[model samples]
Target: MKKSILKWCMLAFLLISNLAVFAQGGTEDTPEPGDGTEPIDSKLIWLAIIGIAFAFLYFANKRKAVRA
Candidate 1:
């Protein structure tokens, strides 16, 4: 039992130390308006939403049909 406890303590210490080493420093630069990034298309988002709604309705109808 004592050996198991020691092993867990060592593991926790290594994990915490590695987290500090991997931590990132702050960046100085920030983006401004019209940074030449293309705007996202709204049509694609609507298509995805409609497709998911249809899929859920299709599955629910199928389940209801099976029960009847």
Candidate 2:
């Protein structure tokens, strides 16, 4: 019972700190990537490729485990 109460107190503390940070707003050094830089679409394509590769590897391993 004591442990559960401590866990909840910790969770509430974390939530309150997160809310405080959000209320402050705009913590970043640079305005979010819109200042005449190269477009992000190419970077997004690379990210998609990386995601697909990981998914393919995951399924391949699963298939091998099933076969074994």
Candidate 3:
């Protein structure tokens, strides 16, 4: 039980750190064609994606429990 909790904590930390690392916008002066100077906030999109992932995991676990 303790090991499982520790593993989950580690996983959460790693995932959050990774997302932070990637979320950093480019430091260059010139923006790409489609991309503008302003950063597009995708908080809603991220929430939706995370929600979907959790929903999938929840349903999958429920299915396995039903089978067992």
Q: Name the regions of candidate 1 deviating beyond 4 angstroms.
A: 30-68
TM-score of each: 0.40, 0.43, 0.39
1-68: candidate 3 lDDT, tens digit per residue: 99999999999999999999889666656766666555557467988999999999999999999999
Against the reference, the lDDT scores of all candidates come to: 0.87, 0.87, 0.86
Residue-level lDDT tens digits of model 1 in 1-68: 99999999999999999999998687686557578643457468888999999999999999999999
Clashes of 1: 0
Clashes of each: 0, 0, 0
Question: Which candidate ranks first by TM-score, i.e. highest?
Answer: 2
Model 2, residue 50: distance off in Å is 0.3
Least accurate stretch of 10 residues (summed lDDT) in model 2?
Answer: 24-33
